[model samples]
Target: MFKSRKNGVNRFAAATATHRQRIQVEHNSVLDSEYPFRLNFYNKPPAMDITIEEFELFALDRLQVLKVVEMAKIRNRSDEDYKKDIQHALDTYLPMKS
Candidate 1:
């Protein structure tokens, strides 16, 4: 409950100034081993510039791909069949290569 001389500010709060200071950080400084999904941590969402339409498309595409994988598993397909089915779904929805 200490007081400042000049403006009568809380001296106790000033004494704990370091605790109130925001931490200076560089992006991606945290180690991957310490944080799985380093880019997608709960505190840090990915920075993306996309239209709402594009975002919905990406979300729907991922859902479709996941659904395919789940269906293949429920069918109890052979390992090769499962792999091929998932691969085909990924190719259609989340294509990485031409």
Candidate 2:
């Protein structure tokens, strides 16, 4: 059986409790009782933007390359060879936009 030590101090538990209280206060402040729309930090952005479809495509390309890198690592490849393979994958999947 695990028992809490009287002499030992739990700093993590105290910090977690403080964080949870702060999050609750922030969530309560943002809650909109009347309107469906709630204003938050994400609403504001620069004029330059990419559409969701394009973003998804970019994410998919990166994910594919990551899978390859992970597989290379799993195979116990050398660090230099892993780096080269990762760089090659990135170059092939994510070409510079011109």
Candidate 3:
């Protein structure tokens, strides 16, 4: 067991912080290997395969997010509320980590 300081923090935890960060960077690299970039301006087709159900679900979710933005614009919402609504729609429908 690692010796703990008065604050109950372990020295080993601090010592391994860099190791954890390195592991996280490697994990992110692996995850991004699938479709790293947000856009494909060159018209490149996606290489990954998805089930039919997954494809439909993704399509519907994207449509919902677009509709939310459309409705927000039609309603002429305030700037703050507009951003909040858009964020809510994206988080609820088509969330992707940056």
Which candidate has the top score in TM-score?
1
What tens-digit string does per-residue lDDT give for candidate 2 at 1-98? 99979879688987887788433435553354443256645544456889999999999999989898999999998989999988889888987756
Q: TM per model?
A: 0.52, 0.50, 0.50
**Pairs clashing in candidate 2?**
none
lDDT of 1 by residue, 27-63 (tens): 6655554455546445554466789999999999999
Which stretch of 10 consecutive residues in model 2 shows the poorest summed lDDT?
Answer: 21-30
TM-score of 2: 0.50
Model 2 gets an lDDT of 0.79
Give all candidates' CA lDDT scores. 0.84, 0.79, 0.82
**Candidate 3 accuracy as lDDT:** 0.82
Best by lDDT: 1
